[model samples]
Target chain A: MVFQSWSYVGFLLITILVVRLTSASWRWLPLLLASLFFYSLTHWGAFVILLFSIFYTYFTAIRVSGSAHMSIRYRWLLLSIIGQVLILGVFKYLGFFNGVMQGVYALLHKGDWNDWPLLVLPLGISFFTFQSMGYVFDVYYKIRKPEMHLGKYALFVSFFPQIQSGPIGRSKEMMPQWTSISLPSFEQYRWAIQLFVWGLLKKFVVADRLGNYVDEAYDTVGSMGTWVWLFILVLYTVQLYADFSAYSDMAIASARMLGIHIPENFAFPYKANNITDFWRRWHLSLSGWLRDYIYTPLLFSKKKWKKWAVVYAIGITFVICGIWHGASMTFVWFGVVQAMILICEMFTKDRRLVWAEQWGRTYQWASVVLTFWVISFCFILFRADDMYQVAGVLADMGQWNSSLLTTYLAEKNISRLMGILFLLTMFLWGDERWDRWIKQPQMSMNKSVLAISLMLTVLMVLGVFGKNDFIYFQF
Target chain B: MSNEELTARVYGVFRKVFKNEGISVHRETTAKDIAGWDSITHLDIISGMEEEFDVEITGFEVMNMSNVGDLYDLLTQKLAE
Candidate 1:
């Protein structure tokens, strides 16, 4: 059922055809059924959990909006959010908490504690929970009205294109689109196909090719030299962005073919000159959700704390962001590192602005390079399985062995690796140029067809079709 | 205060918080329209508005404000109260 597969292609085509043939008012019926069918294919148990979440959030939202008293509305909002958090905690963090307890027992030299049986993490549990909880929050704040239709609400929560990994749709944006689904026009379909093909090039050709090297380096981190570690750090960052954003592009394109628009997830994040700018551009939807729901409330509630409130908000928000990623300490550290950098940036904002004015282009270029390295180093925590592996990787960085670099260079696939890197560079360059051209109204259909054809050819020739699951699927 | 007076005061708060005396905001002005108006500086603006108008703004009201017009409306209601 993965979007990258041929079977998914057939499923999407059939679903689109059926929806198009269905009456306008009833288009949602086929889409809802298809989305549920898609989820059910993942796991029946997880599907049941998703259904429960939809029902619980749906009913809770209605109750919140229905309540006349502020206290009552607050209570319901708190109850619903806690319920969602508890569900996420059990499914996603039980093992993490259990490991902490085991460490305590081992420290006391007691008998080994039995391991807890971890539940299967439903795919995209984090995404759906956050999305649904955001809906409830909006209702409480009166940002948007609660959708009274149960089926439409269910489709909003479980929409197949975004359910697995999201550009996390808001109810206000997505609910209205469902009530009036229509077939995409010829131009729209052409653009969507071009988008999908481009995503395929990124995922199959660039990401997977790079993933090969990243995996091999991490697999033998203890034996790697500094040069190998450097490559690992940089390559893993690229691999992650390519893999996750590729998924988003395809998901958006799939939804676009149905004339539904999801939010853009990435915006040339690597071009950002600072950590703050990077967050604004990277994983835009999730960051928006966090800012609106978590950070804003936390900061406003403690506005009297002044600058400390910003620090506190950044710290707490990113810790939650980290835990939202997984039940691992590595992820927590990842969040902590980002929060620390952001806090530093906030305090030094004025100083940096003055430096930007003084140093001009050189300062901006230096800032971008520094920010990229900072992010790449932080991603080491993201990529490592455990602290021990992270330690091993860092320790390997001190081994300055030129012979190892020479051996790596002499590997048989070096030419292919270089070719993939070239393609990756070209893709990034083309993306910037495409953004500039897309805003202009004179874009020709012939150009789109040619671009799509070229991308498909490149994908066929170079794509590593090992059926790699998108990296974000686990989160 | 009149609506125009309230808007002018709001613009003053924006200028003070962002440290740009020449900054201009319209009814449609959003965070994107200003250089330093982001999530980090947003609280400063809210606090600045509160200080300027002597009104307490809730998170609910803040969340509802999408543009300067919405903020002007919120301030008008708060001032009326």
Candidate 2:
């Protein structure tokens, strides 16, 4: 069931009520069952697959522990990673890979292999697969031991709130939270409710509203002007943040209702002065996971590099990360551009500001203008249908060199510029001070309760009334 | 270098790389064993060791060196030659 579903909401309400009514283990038992029921609503068959994955890895880990030699241990570790990736590839990327291979084969006159049945994309397969694999890999590396208990392990993988979209909680982070059988405190409830409300505002009011313009511009297929495509792409940066962060905000808040404290998933991503800062802020859990598992391993594995080599690894990892999102050329180029910009920054150090300073006031302001435009230009790839569309969009953007500023987009779309401004300001403002604002301590229980109640009321009116799914669900 | 000298130098590298001067060093300590040590900070430590000692490290050794003692042994063997 969707977090936004009426049945789910009703179930959750009953859950909150029952938790308040009971104590200790008795309280969480029904909640755990309810969580399973929530997961089963999506695809019961796939849920069985999920259960099998959990069981497979759990047993595989225990079995691997029985092995004697380091080579045996390494074999088991390799098998575990290979099994999980193969499962992910079949469920998530078989179609993706097939599509690519067909095109490549057709070009070579080997003909397309079109006989295979389309693979059904499993919901939350990416998330749960990663979680299970992380368990085995960590055990193999001896970073952490496998949990002897099955129930807590199951709860870790299928924690319904996180099973869908994740802050990609590590075994180290979430395992401790699962150990508890406690009640949600009043403060936790208040903060959870506040986070839920803010998340709703982001998803429904902001994201759904922005989706209207983006959909309109991009839906026309190949006829869309180059400038218009670029416009939608920049707006996507806004859409993506709203979609994913909203999911994370809700996930964290929902976990909080169960007396589980989850980590914060987003920082102020757009306000990032550099791509490095962007990684620091954006989809933090996934980024952190990639760093620990992917980037660091690759970086340290390579021999020591000259100054340029450090920058090269930074560029390479970002590009690889970008391609992992999709096989599209747009994604590839966008990733490379972002990495290149970041590499450029590594060489500049404080010299960037120094150059601006030496160039005086007009040049400094011009630099800021240049910086913002360049970043926006890179975002064009993320928004386009393909690289061909990106070319068309970039070409259209160039044509506006002599046109009036007011003609940047259609008349109706022009109204949405206010939203763009709002998004930009909020993002820039969020970086330095939004966390400080939200974390401001409330004075009393009653005041916190009242504030949360009012915020939930607003969310009920604005957020829950819509039919939109959380944007990060697809990713 | 003796194990004790190697241990102290590796500990110094750890403390400096992680930027926590007050960290107590021990042979059994992993990255998580130390308070406030994280992946990014650990990379800083590895990077610092490479530059300071002028010795190259394999990715295999980096991954396997979970504790202070593991690093100390690896450094001692490399520095010996």
Candidate 3:
């Protein structure tokens, strides 16, 4: 069940009540059972995958840590990582490879290759796998000790709130808290409810609504003008940010109410002035994971290559990042485009800085806008159906038709569009404005009542109850 | 080398890599304590230290060094060996 659904809300309320009422010794029982129940909601078969990941990584990590010989530890680490990657490959990309092979056979004039029936992707496979594998890496590297308790480690892997869409908690940060379950404080509850309210509003009022427009545009991109395509790209970018960050916000808020703290995922990414800065701000958990686990090792592997090593590492890391998203060539191309832009930014860093100094803040603002547009275009690669659609959109960039807007206005009220823009601006630039306003120490009873009333009003008006799956669930 | 001597050489490497000769480091100094000591600059510093001290540092070892003090200890131990 998705977080935005009433069923999940009811489930969470009951779970919170149980946690609050239960003793510390038996607290993991309820949460673990709740998490397993949540996973069972996805597919009964998926639990097998999650169990394999948790047990395999858990056992190997302990073995890696206990081994005195570097060779033995390294072997365990390699085995664990490779095994996790293979599982991810089988579930996430096997069908993708089969399709590519079929195309190859067709090109070679061979008869059709009978493809096996595809397996359904288990929910949160990417997230839980990455998190568990990170723990194994940490243990092998001696960065932290592995948790010996199976239940706690399993909770770390299958934490219900973040299981579907994650801020991707690390074992070191999460395990200690999982071992010690406590009732949330009054202040924690207050903050959690506030964050939940805001996240719900963003997802319901902004992201889902924009999703409608994005869907309309993407479905008809062939007939849509350049202006329509541009609008769709911008809307899709905002929709993605809103949708994914809303999931993270809700996940983090839910965890916090249970006295758990997950990391923040996004930080005003559209405000980033360069591709490098953008990566730092966008999907921060994944980016940080890639930096630490992939980029660092690859960059350091061949120091003789010097700065070239950074470039190569970045390219490879982003390609992996792309593949981690899905098993599509478009995703791979998205990574390639991002890597190329970043490399260009790197090569031109000195020149750009000099230009910035000469031209001042305006140049920097232009860079920010340029970066946003570049990202939006790359996201087209991410969101488009195939390479043909990508080529069609790019080739038709110059074609403009004013009728698209006129027709939109004829169909929908301009005031509603203005309202959406205002909401999007607040959601983007003033993301935490409501939270900050609510957390004021001098908050009066009347103000609190008014805020609650406003929240209820928004929920009743804009919240879509069904089809509430978050965008990142496909990963 | 003594701890003090090893720390001095480490300081030289940090100064050159971070490009700030005046920047001071101590036992508790971490990435946040210094400017431009982010992930990318971190590799440059690691490479600089390796070149300066002629010690082979693995990625695992680098990951384990929480602060300058750990690096100093590792370097001194490696140098003594």
Candidate 4:
């Protein structure tokens, strides 16, 4: 069930009630059943594949942890990674690979070959595989102990709140909480509700509204002027952040209600001064996973290369990051561009710090603005469906006309647009402060009530209650 | 070298790698406690320590070293060897 729906709300309430009523030791049983039931709602195929992943990784990790010989452990780790990657590759990339083969066949003048049937991508397969693989890595590295309990390990992978989209939880943080499941205190409930309401406002009011404009612009890409395309690019970047971060907030809130803390995914990424900083803040769980599991090992293995080792690692890691999002060349290019930017930032770190000190706050502000624009432009590649669309959008940037901007502005809902702009400004201004306030151990009841009530009122009055599934759901 | 002397030498490597003169690390100090000691600078610190102490640190050793104390322990073991 989608997190925003009334059915999900009811499901969550029932699940929480069940958990609250269950004895401490038996709590995980009901929670695991609920999570599986929740996931089964998507597709039985997805359900079966998820089970395969859980079982495979569970056994592999145990094998890795059980082995005494370092070579045996290393071999098991490779086997586990291959299993996860093969699952991801066949399900996610088969179509893209098939299409590539078709192109090659056409080039060779080969007559129509039989097409292979594509399997439905299990929802959150990308997330869970990475998470499970990370668990295996942790076991191999001895960063944390291997979880021997099959039921608890499955719950860690399929926990309903974060199963679809995640802050991508770690076992060390989540496993203990599951074993010690307890009902959230009243303050915790209040905080979860507040976070949920804020996420709703971000999704329905801000993201969906901006999405309307972005979708419209993409729908008529050929006719849009350069200025309009640029505006739409910026809007898409904001919409993505709002949409994805909204899902993360809701997920974290849902998990928090069960007293399971997931990682924070986004940290005001737009305020970042460079691409490297942006990655650190945006999708923090995934980036942290990559840094710790992928980039660090790769760099250290080639540490003899010194600085070039970092460059090599960054390039490979981000290319994988791009492919991790989907099976498209545009996604690959998106990763390549980010890797390029980060490499530049790495090489210029000392110089940039010197510049920051020389120019102080002005340099910081300018860097933030510049980074936002760079991210916005790069997101054009991300937002487009394929390379052709990316080319069209980039080509459109060459045709500049001011009158088209006025026409574009005139055609849209000006009042709604103004409202979105105002809300966006207020959100940017108060986001960190609001986050800090809600996270405090003790908040004044009166202030909490007032804040939540105001947010609910805004959401009800302004939210576009259309069937806009979260953008990241596609990934 | 004594543990104190080794820790002092490691702290010196951290300071030089991060370019911060006032930096000090203790047993409990971690990457979170330092501003620039991320995955990237982490390698720099490792390399600097290797140079300063004339020892080789394996990737496994680096991964296991979660804090300054861990590093100090690894260094002492390496130096003794």
Candidate 5:
């Protein structure tokens, strides 16, 4: 189930209550059952898809582990990754791919557009597929041992909090936690509540409000002026972050509440100085999963041809990543632009090092900011509906007449922009830096704790706009 | 090759890959210690070391490789056995 859904949360609360009363060993079962119910609720017919992944990977690992025949074991691993990816393609990309193929065929005058029809995308298909593939790839590399138990493996893939737009957990980070039964500790509950409230604020107070502008602007990009275009670009930056990260924070918080600790998926990504650094922080789980499986394996393509390998690695990984975002050309372009930047960063590393050393930290920060703006501008392509709209937005960005500012920046727009700026700055800034209280207990205060708790209560009451799914879910 | 020569060759490979001057051969040096030692250069260094030392690296070896010393040990074992 999507982490924000009340049904999933309700089931989770009941499971936590049961675990609090019962032994820890049995806690895993209730959550596992809840997770199954959660998945079934969304796409009961496709529950078999997750089951197929689990059984395919589990048995493959069991059969392949420490096997004498290396090629045979590797073939199993390849077959598993390929199989899961094919399933992911069917569920996630069938419609978009078919549409695109039809368009391409129409352009070529080889076939009629009516030949291909769109298909319904199964819920959580992208995330669970990636998680399962990562698990199987980890086993193939022999970095992690296969989980012998089928139920546990299923739980690992279908864990409710991360079943939707994910902090996609790897076998190494999550499976052990999956096997453990959590106790309902007060500390965990406190943090969970705090995180959940903050996420609620992000989604309702920030993302939804910003969406009011971005939604309209994107829906009709042709009439939009430069100010409107710029505003939407900035708004999209915030909307996407808040929408996805709020979901992430809620997932982490929900999992924490159940005494299951999930990883932090966002890390003040706006503060990132470079595209590479931005990537390092943004959608951290997926990037990391890509790194571990796609990028690292591509590194092993060959030794003597390693330069080509690096180029190929970055190129292919991002292609996979791009397509993973959706069955769309925009997402593909986004991935391509990111890959190009990464490659340039690699190629110019020596010069950059020399420059950084001579320029100092502030200059480095400025450079990173410039890089972020360039990346942000590229995201305009992503925000646009099609090539025509993309061209229109680009023209708007370039056509800066100071005279148009007064007409476009109405008082309402100004207030919205200011509010967005404030929220985004707060979101981008590092949370609660322990700047020199390193020796001391940094977060010390029982009195302030009450104040914090009260703030959370207020935030939750004020913040939830209610029932918005994560933006990435559509992809 | 002796462990010392292997270490020297690997160090040379890293120096060449990273394009950093005055890099000294040491078993303790890590990727973190060198400027421009990102994943891209990492592959270059590993590939160069593999070619120079004429030993294949398992993905496991690449995963666990931390410091230059680990490379030395892996190289030694691969060459000797």
Candidate 6:
């Protein structure tokens, strides 16, 4: 269940009560069971896939790390990675590959190819498998010890809050927490509740409302004017950020309430002035994981490539990242665009810095706006159904008119849309103020209560409490 | 090599690679301690250390090194080996 649902609310409350009532030593049992229960709510078969992966990685890691023979350890490591990738491939990318093969056969004038029903992609398969692969690598490299306890490792793999959409936990970061359970502190409870409520506000009031316009605009059959496409594009970008970051905040806050600290996923990515900096601030855990596991190793693999190694590594890593998003050509092109821009940024760093120094704050703000628009342009590919839709949207760029304005104004919920925009502005302003003020002193209880009550009121009235499937869940 | 020699060589490497002469690394000095000391420059530093010391640094060693002190200790140990 999504964090916004009443079912999740009930589950979380019960979980908190159970954990608080239990002894510290036995706390993990309930938590683990609860996690499995939550995960299996999607499909019992998905639970089985998760279990097999957990056991496979746990055993493989222990063997890889504990092996006496160097060659044998290397073999185990390779096998584990291959197995995990194969599993992800079978479940997620089989349809894409099948379609490619069929197209190839048609082009070659071969006989008609038989179509097979694609396998159902288990929820969180991509996330958990990637996480497990990272763990096996960590163990093989001796960066972290393989967990001896199977149960703890299982918990690390299937932690319910982060299972659906993740800040993708590393074994080194999360294994120790699962090794032992601790009662939630009062401070933890208070912080988690506040963050959870804030996440709900972002998701329901801001993201979902923006998503309504985005979905409507994107689902239109024909092309739109340039202004309409760009407006809807910006709305999708904002909606995605709000939705994904909202999921992260709730996941982290939920984990925090259980005395586990998951990593923060976003850090004001729109503020980034360049593609390189944008990746650093967006989905930080996945970026860091890829840097450590994929990019760095590729960069360091060959001495002859020298300076060009980083360029090659970045291209490869981002390509993999795009494919990891989905089995779609649009996603592939999205990764290619990002990598190309980053490589350009790398090459022009000296000139860019010189320009920055010459132009000062105006240049910096200009760069930020430019980066946002460029990213929003790329996000059209991300939001499209296929390449045809992408072309349709791009082909209609010339028809600039006031129809978009007239049409949006004609919608019945125009006032609600305006209200959302106002709330968004207030949220952004208040967040900046709070960031600066939070370090000075804690808020008084009365002020805190009044602020939270106001937030709750807004949540009750303005919140779009509709179907709350998080956007990232599709990946 | 003596620790003094190693430190001087490392200091030179940092200065040349990062192009910042003001950087000074000690036991507690980490990536956070020095401006422009990111993963890209981190690779340069690793290459520099390996070339200057005439010693290979393994991936394991690279991953485990937390600060200048750890690097120093690792270099000393690798050199002894």
Candidate 2, superposed: residue stretches over 4 Å from native: A17-32, A221-231, A304-316, A327-329, A332-334, A347-375, A401-410, A413-435, A441-467, B1-81
lDDT digits (tens) for residues A236-317 of candidate 2: 6677777788788888888778777789888767655555656778788878777766666666655355454556566677
User: Which pairs clash inside model 1?
Assistant: none
Interface RMSD of each: 1.1, 3.5, 1.5, 1.1, 2.3, 1.9
Q: Which residues of candidate 3, in runs, are more than 4 Å off?
A: A403-405, A432-449
In the range A1-475, model 5's lDDT, one tens digit per residue, is 5555576567778877876776766667777787887777766567777777778777877766757687988888777777887787777777677778788988999867663544446677888888887887778667788898778888888888888778898888787875566675565576566667567666776677777777777776555566667767777887888788878878888887777878878776776777888888889999988887778767775545657778888899988888788777777887898889888877876687678889899767897678767767878756666667777777766756655667556745777567667766655553323111211223345633764576556566545465466777876
Global CA lDDT of candidate 4, please? 0.87
Off by over 4 Å in 5: A5-8, A115-118, A182-184, A411-413, A429-467, B1-36, B58-73
- How high is each candidate's TM-score? 0.97, 0.82, 0.95, 0.97, 0.89, 0.95
lDDT of 3 by residue, A1-475 (tens): 9888789889999999989888877788788989989898889778898998999999999999998999999999999999999999888899888889899999999989788677879998999999999899888878789889898889999999989978898877888787668888776677677678778877887788988888777666666667767777888899999889889889988988877788888877998998889998999989988987898888878656777887998899999998899888888999888888888887887798789899998998899999889899899888877888788777656667788667766666888777777877776677556546854545655766677678768977987655568889988
Q: Model 1 segments beyond 4 Å from truth? A: A412-414, A434-442
Q: How far is candidate 4 from the true structure (C-alpha RMSD, Å)?
A: 1.6
Q: Model 4, which residues run further than 4 Å from truth?
A: A107-114, A438-441
Displacement of residue A323 (Cα, Å) in model 1 is: 1.0
Summarize candidate 4's per-residue lDDT along B1-81 as a digit string, tens digits: 886788778878877887888987788899999887777788888889889998888787787778888988888887888
In candidate 1 the C-alpha lDDT for residue A305 amounts to 88
Tell me the DockQ of each model, to 2 decimals: 0.75, 0.33, 0.64, 0.67, 0.43, 0.48
* Candidate 4, residue B35: how far the Cα is off, in Å: 1.5
TM-score of chain B of each: 0.92, 0.81, 0.91, 0.92, 0.87, 0.90
- Candidate 6, residues A322-395, lDDT tens digits: the string is 88898899999999998899889988988999999999999999998899899999998788988998887887
Quality class of the docking in candidate 4, CAPRI style: medium
Best by DockQ: 1
